[model samples]
Target: MGIFKRVKHMATADTNHFLDKMENPVSMVKQYIRDLEEQMGQAQQALAQQYWNERRYEAQIEETTALIMKRSRQAELAVDRQEDAIAELAIEEKLRNQEKLALYKTQHEATKNQTAALLEQMKRMNEKYNELVLQKQNLLSRIRAAQAIQASTAALQPYDMDRVHHGLARIEEKVWQVEAQAYAGIKAGEVLNAAPSYVEQEKRDEIQKELAALKEKRGTV
Candidate 1:
């Protein structure tokens, strides 16, 4: 049992390490952006529905206002005709419609306020999303610069001073021999010219310039 437990623990540790290695910051940030986009879409739908509710309340309020006015006029006409029961019924309906109009107005105002709140929330979320995008860009730029620097550093490592000096010594000897031959040919009335040797310093300078440019692009310098 103890051996089995030890094996299980080792397996778990290895799995965790593998999972950690698989986690990429850039991919994670992109996924977060996608999630935010989905949420924004849902929020927009909710806002649209809220606006619909506000409109529905406004329509109800208009209908209630018209009913109140109609009931009031009906009550007046019934009184003029000496129909007391009809007048009473119209007055009751007028009062009921007035109450409904007030309620509808209150509901409409609340819906409008909720819509505004939703708009503000969406504004804040959009701002946050933009900020995350900027951060992701900066992170990517830095990663690329780091990778370039690492490769350049590795390439330079093999060309250390000892190796460089040894290589230069051989080239210098070869150049000296070439010069001696050229001088001998010249003395014999024959001109001999050798092409220039490769310049390692220029290549080193170019690599350095490339590194500096990458740093600048990454905003590190």
Candidate 2:
């Protein structure tokens, strides 16, 4: 069987049914492309063999034709020498050669036709295989793009804005509490540092007594 016949069989198959039966369409397409490549290789080998067979048949035809011509000349020479027995023998040989030549010619024609047909089939198969490869790549790209979109949509679907807002508010409140504590510590430290010394307090009391005595002298005690 030739690859073309197999390709024809595939062409007639129900593609939608096949896809429905498959667990993964992408993997199936990949496998189909591989099969096409393998078939193409086989088809090439078969085409080469057909060509060789055609050449062999042509060589046989040519050799048989030469033999037929030689035998005919021998028969003519025997008849010219007046040898009936020899002439009859040469004639029989010529007839046999003619029959073989006819058979070879028929085989050559048939082989030539077959070779041409196989070559054409192989050419078509190669073209189809290339087309399938391109289609497989495009399909894979589309599948990837669809998966990415689906993933992105899934990520967005479960988002919780309220939860995020509550978390942020809690963090802000903690920051404010830390700031207030820091400010209170700074104010307390400043108050402790600003307390009066003992000498400064005694000078303040002496100034007050002098102001009171001056007031008494002025009869304004």
Candidate 3:
């Protein structure tokens, strides 16, 4: 309604149009893929770290279980030797190792589950990313087809073709006029050459007069 408002609206529209033109599908898709790859890489790294923790927990559980067995054997030997102090110490160490083994086992199971879930998530992301790539290819093919059709349509525009035809018609008319002029000149030349010349007709008439005079002179008129 207002001039300033109209100007502002026009400017915004123009900016949006410019941005749309600048937004190339290929570049946009490539950027999107790059971002997806980055995220996937980060996810993979985190999964790898999780797997490392699980392995560490497993190693710790194995070591702790071995220590617990060793302590139990040591406690039994001490008891057989009637060494109460050594047996008590071995029993305490076995209990601590057992606790450590339990904690390690729990952590290992939790980490293993988390790693499995992350792997499934990563698989889904890869599938989706592949689908996006295929869609990009399809989009490009359609765009190319549309561009070709648009170019052909532009070349065959009726108004442009009409102008071409009009130019050809003008040239044809000029050629016809030139041919007509040449034909007219040939006809005129033929008519002039077909008739007797004035000088030749006069010469014939003079010869006839002379013959009549000669006959009269001879008295054979």
Candidate 4:
């Protein structure tokens, strides 16, 4: 009972101190599994020893019983005082071994039961650990998706919008330049646009000389 009491105290730890050494959920779960395996192994070993002790106690009891029976037969043949004492001591030893054998059998069962319960606890803890692992993976996946979407949106946000505005402004300036060139040509004067050749100048001078003779004849007649 004393040994089991100490072990019980170690196994029953639940809060703060038990979790203080754990760094993360995965490491915590692994450590918990390891500790559970160690405890189960120890309990099983104790159970095995208890069974061996029971068997040895039984064998000793049988040997002592045989000794007691042989001495009884000898005492019946010769009623010696020392022989009677020997027979009585043999009976007491047999009773002691019997008691020990029963106690060991009980201890073996208790150890086996403790091991089984710990195994069940380990099973439940494993299920919980797996669930938490899945949750962490899902959260990571969602976070990645969210980051990608944010990056895409930022690329499309048009942060440097002045570039497009400047392009349109340059196009308008080119149109005004073309319009100004057309107006400038119109203002340069029509004479510069259509100058007569030397042959057209001679024809104009001959027509002016004929008009001067007609005017002289009309005045003398």
Q: In TM-score terms, which candidate is top? A: 3
Encode model 2's per-residue lDDT on 182-203: one tens digit a residue. Answer: 9999999887776656567788
lDDT of 2: 0.79
Rank list by TM-score: 3, 2, 1, 4
Candidate 1: tens digits of C-alpha lDDT, residues 54-88:
98998999889889989999999999999999999
Taken over the whole model, the C-alpha lDDT of each candidate is 0.78, 0.79, 0.78, 0.61
Give per-candidate clash totals.
0, 0, 0, 0
> Candidate 3, overall lDDT?
0.78
Question: 1-221, model 3: which lDDT tens digit per residue?
Answer: 63223323332333223335655866666665675676678778878899899889988988898899999999999999999999999999999888888888888999998888778767766775786688578768988999999999999876778889999999999999999999999999987886657667888999999999999999999
Q: Cα RMSD (Å) per model?
A: 30.3, 5.0, 10.5, 8.8
- Give, for candidate 2, the lowest lDDT window spanning 10 residues: 7-16
Measured by TM-score, how close is model 4 to the native structure? 0.45
Of 1 and 4, the candidate ahead on lDDT is: 1
lDDT, residue 98, candidate 2: 83
Q: For residues 16-100, write the lDDT of model 4, one tens digit per residue.
A: 4554565654456456556555655665566567556556655655665576566556555444546666656655665665566
- Candidate number achieving the greatest lDDT relative to the actual structure: 2
